[model samples]
Target: HEPVPTEWTRTTCPYCGVGCKLEVGVAGDRIVATRPVIDAPSNKGHLCVKGRYAHGYVDAADRITVPKVRHDGRWRSTDWAEAITLAADGLRRVAAEHGPDAIGVLGSSRATNEENYLTQKFARVVIGTNNVDCCARVCHTPSAAALKHMLGTGVATNSFDDIEQAKTLLVVGANPLENHPVVGARIRQQAQRGAHLIVIDPRRTGLARIADVHLAPRPGTNVPLLNSLAHVLFAEDLVDRDFLAARVEGVEGLAAFMAPWTPERATQLSGVPADAIRRAARLYALERPAMALHGLGLTEHLQGTQGVMALIDLALLTGNLGRAGSGINPLRGQNNVQGAAVMGCDPGTLTGSVRLVDACQRFEAAWGVALPHKPGLNAVTMIDAAHAGKLKALYVIGYDIFASLANADVTAMALSKLDLVIVQDMFLNETANSFGHVFLPVVSSFEKDGTFMNSERRIQRVRRAVAPRGDSLSDAEVLCRLAGELGFGDQFRHTCAEAVWDEIRAVWPAVAGISYGRSSRHGLQWPCVDEYDPGTAVLHARRFANADKAKLEQVDYRPTTECTSEQYPFLLTTGRTLHHFNVGTMTGRTRQQLLRPTDTLDMHPYDAGQLDLRDDMPVRVESRHGEVVLPLRVSDAVAPGQLFATFHDPARMLNRLTGPVRDTVTSAPEYKVVAVRVRLA
Candidate 1:
C-alpha cells in the first residue's frame, strides 16, 4: 500500500500536549509514513492513532499554497510582495485612522516558541500595541493564574516520568484515553501494577470505568467535591503537619475556611457520596506519593481559577509537593499552550509572566523603541471593542477564533464589524472563508524549524521534514518580512531558526541556558538557569518558589448564575473527541474522516426516553444564545440530565450554546456547563 522511504526526519508530533517523538518517512517530498521512536522520554515508543495516520492532510489538494487577497468577496492569487504590501498598507490605514490601540493582533498556541516570540514582539515593537493574546485565554489561563497565586511558578510540579513512581494517580476533569492516548496507556499499565487510581468527573469516561474510586460530581460543583476531600484530610488528621510547617503558610485560617464544607453537606450539593469522598481522600493521602492531573473540565467554568486552587489545596495538605511521584499538573489542551504563554503572548505580561512595565527597560533598550505603558485589551475584550466600534483591525494567526470562542453568534458579529482581517494559515479556514481580507499561506510545524514545549515543560525540537510544497513560508519569515515592509526589518532578520532561538535565550533569563545544541536529543526542561546547570525534572524539591513557602487562598463554592428552569432543563458540555483535533481544520482533510465523519450529541437513555426520543433521531438543541440540530445517540457514558458533544465540526457550531459567563479572575469562558433544551427536529 505504500512505498519505501528514501529519508527519515525525527521530530515531535504536532497534535496534543503529549508531544510524542515521531520519525517521519518521506519519499521525494511526499510523506510516506510515521513511526514511534523507542527512547522518547515523553511517549516511550507509543504513538496515538492521530499521530501515526494523520499525515494525509499534509498533502491535501485544497491547501492554500500561495498568497491571495479577497476582492469584492472573491479570491484572487497574488505575489508575496503585493500581498505583504497590501497587508501593511491596510494596517497602516487602520492605525492612522483610529490610533495604535485600536488594532488587535492574536498569537497562536499551535505555533512554535520562536514564532510566538516574534508574534508578540511584532505587535509591541512594530505596531506599538498590547492588544495581543492567544487561544489559551479560552482554556488554561486560569490554571496558570491560580497556580502562580499559590506557588511562585505556574506550571506542572512534576514530570510524566513520575508515573512510574506514583503510588496513586488522582485524575480530575480529564479523559486521557480519548485525548492523550499514549499517556493513557501508561496510566492503565500503572494501574495494572497495583497503583491506586481515583477519577473525579461528571461523565463515565474510559478511565472512570476502571478506576478504584470514581466520584461523579454534578456540573459546576468542583469546589464542593474538592472541598469535601480537603475536609476529610483535616478531619482525620491525615495531613502532613511537618510538610505544612516547613513548606506552606496560611494554615492558621484554613480551619475556619474549611469548617463549613463537611463531607455530608458537600455531598448534598456535589452529588458525590460522603462515604466515597472519605474513601477517596484516605486512599490518596495514605498512598504517600499521588499525582493530581486535571484538564479543561476543571478550568472552563465560572469558578475556573478557584477550582484550580482547590485542587492544589489537596496536594499541599498531604505534603505531595517536591517529590518524584506526587505533584499538581494541568493536562494542557494545546501542544504549545504553556509555551505560548511563556513566550509573552498575553496582553498583560512579557516572557516568564513578567509584567510589561518591569521588563520595559530591558526590551526598550534592546529594540531601540519605547514600549507602550498602557494596558491594552485582551482577546475577549478586543472582540467586544470591535463590536462597539472602538477596534477596527485584526491580525489572526493559526487559530479559528470565530469557531473556537464562546458565544459564536456574538463573535461573528464582532468580527464582521472589523475593518481589516488578515488571516495567516496553511489552508482556507472557517474565519478566512467569511471575513479574511488578506490570506498569508504559511507552512505547518512539520515544514518549519523551531521548538515546541509540551505539557511537562519539556522543550523539544521541531525539525523541517520536507521543504514547502509551493510558495509558502514559515511563520517566522512572514513576521520578519512584514516588519521589513513597516521599516523595522533589520532587527528581526534572523538567518535561521536557531538564530531566532539564540535571541530568545539572550532576552529571557528563564530559558537562557537552553540552547539548540543541548536540547538536540531528548530536549531540556525549563528553569535551566546557566549553561552548566542541568534542567530540572521535578520542581519545588528543596524549597517552594515563593520564598520557600506556599500560601493557601481561602475561597468558597458559589453557584453559576446561568440557572436552568422549565424552558431549558438539561445541561450541555463541550469537548474534543479522539478522532479529531480542535475545529477539524487539518484532520477533516485527512483519512481520519473514515473513522468519525461528523459530530453527534451523546445523551443518556433515560433522558431520551423522557423526551420520547430514540437512537439516531435528529434533535434540535436550543440554548438561550443559539440553536443547532444534531443526531442523537442514546448512551450511558454521560450521567442523566447531562449531554456531551465535540466542537471539532464547525458545521455543527456547538459553541453557539456556550455563553459569555467567564471566570471572574481569568476570562476563560465556562464551556463545561450550559442550560439547554432538546426536542425532535
Candidate 2:
C-alpha cells in the first residue's frame, strides 16, 4: 500500500491580534502538526509558540461535548433542543418580568465576526435590548474611543507591513515580544535595519533592551512624559507646520496646554532624564516617517484616554499621519476584539462605527425590528446592576468573569445573584462552574468556518480543518437556533456562516467589498468599499473619515486614583508572559502549561533586599481590595518601588489585587497601577 498524505487546512491563529496565518495538518480527525503560511501579509510565515502548539487544547479531555442545564444546584447533560428551549425560555421569562434592559449579552473576543454579528443582532432585534458588550470593555475600549475621536478611526492607521519603512519607532507601554510575538519579530527586524527604537515603559522589556533610548518612567506618568515630548517638539521648532496647516485641527491650543510640561518639569515627575526626553523627541521629530505603537500600559490608567491622545498629538505634531511608515498603532491584546466591536457588540455603537441613533434606523430597515435607542450598561456597570438585583439575566460567550474581572469575589457574587446565567464556551471555567445556569458547549476555531478581523483591521478567513468535536456546535449555530426558538426565525434563518457574513457585508459599508471568495486567497484590510476594490493598506492618506482634517486635543496629566502610601509602599503592575495566554483557558490545557506552570511575583532586587526576600521565596502581595500569595522572583526589570506579575495562573488571581477604578471616558479598569504592601509568607 502507498503512504497516505495528511490533509492540510489554512486558518488564522486564535491567540493574539497579530493574526498569523497557520497551516494545520489533520489525520483522521486529529491535528498532527502545525506550520506557518509563507505568503500571509501580516505575519509572513512567523508564528508565536502559542499559535503553533496550542492546538492540543482542541482534543483535551475536558472539552465540553454536550449541553447541560442546572437542576437542584447540579448539572445534567442534555440534548441541543432541550437546552435551547430552556435557555430561550429563561431569557424570555426574565425579559417579560424585568424588562429587556435587565438582560445583558457579553459577546466573545475569541468568536468570529459573523458570530459576534449574530450576538448583537440577537440581543437587539430578538430581545429588543442594547445591553450588549464584548471583552474590549476591559481592554481596548479606551483605544477605540480615543482613537476614533482624534483620528476618525478606531483601528491602526497603517498596516504592519509599513513598519519596515519607518526611520524611528516609538513603542510605549507595550511588551509585544511576549504578547504579540510575530509583530515583536517585525519590530526587532526593523531595529536591526537601523530604525531608531524608543521604548517608554516602567520595566525594561525585551525590546527596551535593544532600544536606542529607554525612558523608564514611573507607572501612571505616561501623560506627563508624552506631553513633555510634545513640548520639546514645539520648543525646538521640530514640528511639521505644513502638515498641521493642511490636515490637522486644534494645534493652536496644544502649545498653551503643553506649556507647563517642560523637559525639566516632566523629568521631575516621571523619573526619566530631561536630556533623554529631548533626544527621543528630536529623533521622533527629525526622523521622517516615524511611527508610534502602544498597548495596555498606556490605556489601563486613570488618564488612559489622555495618554492615547497625547501619543496622537506627537504623531500629528511630526506630520506622521497619512503616509506609508507613519501613523499611530495600537497592539490589540485579543484576536477578534476588533471584529467584535466593529460587528456592533458594543452598547454605544452599531456595526461599522455607526452611532446608536443612526444604527436604530439602519438596522430596523435591515432586520425588520425596532431597536433600542438608549445606551445600555457596560461590563463594570452590568456587574453592579446584577448585584443590585436590577440585571436579571446574563448570557456570556467564551469569557470567564471571575477569572478576568478586577474583583473576582465581587464578580462571583453578581453572577450568583442573576436569575439566569447562560455560558457558552469550550470548557466549564470558573464562571460556569460557580454560577452558570445553562451551559452551551462551543467548538474551537479549528473546527469552525468564519472570519476574524485582526489588529490592522484585516478580515481573514478561518477555514474548517475538521468536524466539530462530538456534539459541540459553532457559536453561529447556537445563536441562530436560539434566535429561531425566540420567534425570530424568519429574520435569522441563515444555515451557514457565509450567509451571515453576506448579511454583514450588505449592512456594514466599511466591509461591503469583503466576501468569502474575495478573502479566500488572502486577507483584506477593511474600508474595502466595493466588490472590485482592493482593500486599503493605509488609512487617512487623503482625508479622514468624518472630516477632511484630524482633530487634536489638549490633555493634561492626572494622578492615579490609588497612590503609594505608608500602609502600601509599593506599586504593582500586571502583564502577560510569552508562554501563557490570558487566564490560561486554552493554553493551560496544552504543553505550554509545562513551560510555565505557575505565576510568580516579579520584584526589583533593591526591594527584595530591603525586605530580605530571596528568589523563589513565597510572599504575600496585598492591596486595598484583596491579596494573593506567590513565589517571588527578584529581577532588575522592575523599578525599586514597583512589582510585576502575570494573570495566567488562576491560583494567584492577580486581578483580585487591582482596584475598581476605571477610565473616565471608557470604563476600562486601571489594571496597571495598584498600591500594595509585600510581606513574607
Candidate 3:
C-alpha cells in the first residue's frame, strides 16, 4: 500500500560523524525538501551544506537499481535470483579450489547496524573462515585498540555536548570544521566562552584559526610531541598526585621511562617549538578540566596506535577521565564505526572487542557455530593474499574498496585475479568494474529501519521514511534471503532487528542495556551491562580496564615509507572536503559538485613557488608507488613542504601514491605521509 500524502518524515543524514537528524519531505516517492529536525539532540536546528544538499546523489543517474553481472567484458542488467545463484556457485567454486581461507568479506561503515551485523555473521558462520573485516580497520581500529588498552572501553568518554563545560580542549590530527561540522561548531562556541583551545596538526586548519596554541608539527611526529608533553607535566609536578596515587598504577614506571623525552629533544624530531609544548601542557594540567579530542589525522598513520596510546597517557596523567568535561574522544568518521567494531567486525576479535581465540568457547555456545579458533587476515593482508593468488573470492558490502585501498593499480589487478567478486552497493562502483560476477543493490538510509551508533557510543533509531525503490531490498532483508538460499535459513531466522540486537546483547555484555525500546526514549551509550543501568558516557572514571591498573607502553616513532629526498621533497597527504564524502558515491551528483568540481592538490605557497607550480595549473605528483596528474591549488592553510589532495575523484586516483606501511600493532596505513615530488605538467 502506497501512502497518499505526507509533509515530512524524520531521518538521519548520510554524511559525516556529526549525524544530524533531518526531515525528508515527501510528496510521492522523491524527497521534495530536506531540513534539520529541530527536536534532535546532535544538531538542534543546524544542517551542514552536505546534509542539506547532498541527498541529490540518491537519485543520481548511475545508481545500480538492479543486480548486474559482467558478460562479454561489460556489465549487463540481470535479475536478483540469477545473480544470487551465480554468486553462490562462484563462492562454492572458489572455496573448493582455494580453501576456506581464500574467501573474505569486506564490511562497510555506511551500512546499517543490522546490515553490518548480518554481513559479519554470514562471514563467520556460513563462510567457515575468520577472514572478515571492515573499513574500520583503516580508520578507527587503532583508536579501538588504544582505548581498550588504556581505558577498558573504546567508546568516547564524554559527549560532544560536554564541550560547553570544558575548561581546556586539546584537538589533535582532525580538522573538525571540514570533516565534522556540527561538532566543530559546538567546540567553537566553547572556545568563544573562554575555554583554552589547543590544536596540533601538520596543516593549519579552521580550528587552528581561533586556537590559543596551534602546534604545527611535522607529519608522522605525533608520538614524540605527545611524549614530550607528558614529560613536561611530570617534570614540573603538574600531574594530579592524588589521582595518580589513588586511581592509576605504573605511574612511577612510566615517569622513569619518559624521563629522556625532554622538550628540547622532542622539538628536534616534531619541529614544534619547545616553548609551545611546555606552555600547552602546563595550561591543560592547571585548567579545571580538559579534554583530548582526535580524528583520523591522528589514527591513519604509521604509528597511529602508538600515537593514540600517547594521548591516553596524557589523559591519565592529568586525571581527565571519568569526568563531565574531560576525556579522550575519537571523533568517528562515519556513523556506527564504533558500534560496528564493538559488534565484532574484526576477524581477530568478537563483539565487545574480545579476542576471538579467547572468547571462542563462549561465542560457540551462544551461536552454535563452532567458530574458528585461529585469527584471520585483516583488509591489507587479504588484498595482498588475493594478489598473490592465495585468496580467490571477495564479497564487498557498501564500501568502495577499489578507491579506499592503497595503490590503485595493484588493487585493480588483485580484483581482476579473483575468481568471484560480489559487490553489494547502491551504485555500480569501480570495484564492480573488474571481473565481478554478481552485484546486489542495497537500500539507502531513507529506505531502511535500523540503528546507528554515533561517535559518543550512543545508538539512535533510524526509522524508514519511504518504500524500497524498484524491488530493491534493505541489506538485512537481502542477507536473510541469501542465508535461506545458502541453506542456513533456520539458524538465521531473525524476525526483526530487535531479535538480533537482543541476541548480541545477551552474548556481549557491553551493549547489555541497549534495546529498541530503550533507544526510542533516548539514545543509549554503551557499557550498559545491567537491566536497570543507564549507559555509561565516560569510562575509566576510577580505574582502568586491567583491574584499575593502566600500564604505559613504550613506543618510538618511525618515518613513513616514502621519505623526502632531493627530487621528491614534498609530503603528500590525502583527506576529505567540506562538501564531499568518501569517493563521492553520495555527494558527487549533488549541487555541491556545481559549487566545486574536479580535484585540487593543495600546497603551501613556498613549496608551490619552489616547484614552479601555480594555482589551477596542472602538475604531476610522483611517488614510489605511482603518479597522478592533478591541478595544484596554492593555499596558506597547508604548511611548507606538505601537499594535500582530496580522495573523492576517481580520475585523480589519489590513492595510487598511497601504499600500506601499517602500524605494528593496529595495522592502519599511514595515509598522512608519503613523499612526492610536484612538477608542472
Candidate 4:
C-alpha cells in the first residue's frame, strides 16, 4: 500500500472548464489522493467524477518519458540532446525548402497560458511566421470572435455566481449536468429553489426536462429560432426601451433585419411551435435578472458566430448587461480553452487578442526580431494547405488533430504529405502515431507549475503536485530548449513558467496585474489592468452609459450545406457525457474508463422502431465524409429524426463522418448538424 500522504498541494482541476479547486495529497514524489477545496469559489466543495478520479492518469503506463525520433521508418528512443537537435534541424530544412508560410503550429487547450503564449511567440519570432492556431478553432472560437466583435471583450460579461441571483435562466445548446457537473449542479439547484428555468436545445436535456419553458428547435435552425425570439420581444413590446435608448445603436438596422422574422415564420423554419417561442420569450423577458448560459450547441455550426450574437442580443434587448444576476455567459469545454485564445495563439492575433500586424512594431522592439506582418492559415485552412502541398511542416502541441478534426480521414492524408511533423505530448496520440517525425514527451499538469483560465475568465494557480514520471519535461521547458537550439535563445529566455508569465503580464493588458504573488485561493478574474486593481467581476457597468456604448449590429441567419435528403434521412449531433473528457486521452487510462468504456449512437425510440432496431444493436452510420459502426442506444432524449453521440472514445472515430463545413467568421466546424444514414451490417 502507498504510504500516508504527509503533504498537500492546492491546484485547480485540469479536466473540464468549471475550474474546481482541488487539494491533492502527496507522499514524496507520488500523488496519493485528491479532494475538492471547501472554500473554492467556482465549485465550492463540489467535484464531478472526473475531478475525483482522473488523477491516476499522470502515472499511466503508455506515458512517453523520453523523446523519440523516427529512423528508417521505425521508432527509437533518444536523449534530449539528439531529439531537440533533430527537431531543430528538420524545421530548418523545411523552412529552407519551403518558406515560413509553409509551416503551421497547433497549440492545445491542455497547455497553460504561459506555454501557449510562448508557442505563438516561437512561431512568430523564431520561425518568422504567423501560422499558429489553438484547439479553440474547433471548439469555442465562435464565442470568442462573436463576443469580441459584439461586445468589447470576447468573454462572459458577468461571473458564474450570477446563477444564484438570477430569477430566470436561459440555457442554450448545453447540458451542463452531463458536460460540466459542478455548474450543472448549481443550475439544477436553482431550479429546485423555484427559479424560472428556460432551456433551448433540439433534444430534451436533463435541465430541459425540469425547465419551466423548454424550446426545442430543429438542428441547424438556431438563427430562425433566436430571431423569432427577438421578434416576439419587439412585437410584444417586451424590450427594455430605456436601456436601448441610452446605450445601444443601430436599432433601425436591426429592426429592418428582424421585421421578416415572426414566431410563426420561425416555427416554419425551425420545426418549433409559435406558441412555445412566444411563451419562452415572455418567461425570459418578464423575469427580472434573467441570465443566459450556452455551450457548444450555440457554437460548432456554420452560423455559430451569428447565433452567439443573437443570444447576446436577447440579453442586451432585456437590459441584462453589467448586472449581478443577468448577462450573457459561455460554458467552455476544456480547462484552458479561454486561455489559449486569450494568450493569442491564433494566426491573426498577438498577446491579449490584439491584431498581430497592429502590435508588430511593439513586439519587434521587445523581442529584437521583425515579426511576421501577414496573417497565416488557421487550423482547418492549414490542413487544407497541407493536403494541397502548400504547407511542408506542422508542429502539433498536445492536440490530436486526427481525432478531433472534422473529416479526420482527409486530415491523415494531408499530414502524410508533410515533410516534418513534430509532436509534443504525454502520449503518442493518433496524429503523432501516424505522421510524427519527432516526438517530445511532456509532463502532465500535475507535474507542472503554471496556471489555467477557467470558463468564467478567472486565472488560478496550478501548483506542481508530483514530480515528473521520468525524463519528461514541462512544455515551457521543451520550448525554451528548442528555441536555444534554433538560435535567438535570447528572445525566448524563460527559465521557468513564472518567467514566461512575466512577459505575458507585460504584453497582455487584461492579465497585467495578475501576479503569481497574489493570493489564489480565490482566483482573480481578468481586466485587472494594474497592480492595485481588484479585478473585474461584471463588465460594461458605466461604460455602456458613456462613449463606450454597446453597438448593435444587424446580423442575419444563413443555412449550412448539411441538408437532410431521402438518402440520408436522420440528422446527427455530437457532444460529451459526464464520465469522460475530450478524446478520452487522460480519462481512458484512469479508473474512469470503467464507467464508460465505449461509444454509442443515440437514436430516438421511434426512429429505431421503424428499422426494427433494438437497444444495443450494432449499426453502421454513414455520412457524406466517412462512416463508423457504433452500438445503437434507443433513447427518447433525442428527437424522432435526430441522433446523438459522443466522440470521447477515439476508436469510434465519429469525426470521420463530419465534413469541413465551418462558420464563416471563425471557421468553427458544424458538428451539431449533419445528415447520415444508418443500417445494420
Q: Which candidate leads the pack in lDDT?
A: 2
lDDT score of residue 542 within candidate 4 = 72
Per-residue CA lDDT of candidate 1, range 244-289, in tens? 9998888868866888789899889988899999999998999979
Q: What local lDDT does model 3 show for residue 583?
A: 82
Residue 183 C-alpha lDDT in model 1: 82
lDDT order, best first, reads 2, 1, 4, 3
Query: lDDT by residue for model 4 over 1-681, one digit each (tens)?
Result: 767888999998998898999999898788888889998889989999889878878888898999999977888999999999999998998899889999998887999989998899889988989899988998888988878887768888888888999999999999999899999999999989989999999988899999998888889999899999888988898989988888777776777788889999998889998998999899888887898999999999999998999998888888888888888889989999889877878989888888876788988887888888999899999999999999999999999888999888898899999999999999988888889999999999999888999988899989898888889999988888999999969987887888888888987777888998873678799889888988888888877422566777566878888989999998999989988888888988888889888888999988899999998899999999899999999999999999998898888988998888999898888999989999995
Worst 10 residues of 3 by lDDT: 1-10
lDDT scores of the candidates, listed in order: 0.89, 0.91, 0.82, 0.88
Q: Which stretches in model 3 have alpha-carbon errors above 4 Å?
A: 1-5
lDDT of 3 at 628: 92
Against the hidden true structure, what lDDT does model 3 obtain?
Answer: 0.82
User: All predictions: root-mean-square deviation over Cα?
Assistant: 1.1, 1.6, 2.2, 1.3
The parts of candidate 4 lying over 4 Å away from their true place are: 1-3, 544-547
Model 1, residue 265: distance off in Å is 1.8
> 256-369 in candidate 3: lDDT tens per residue?
878999988889988999999999999889985898899888999888999999998898788888788899999988876666767777888877778886798997787787
Estimated TM-score per prediction? Answer: 0.99, 0.98, 0.97, 0.98
Cα-based lDDT at residue 471, candidate 2 = 95
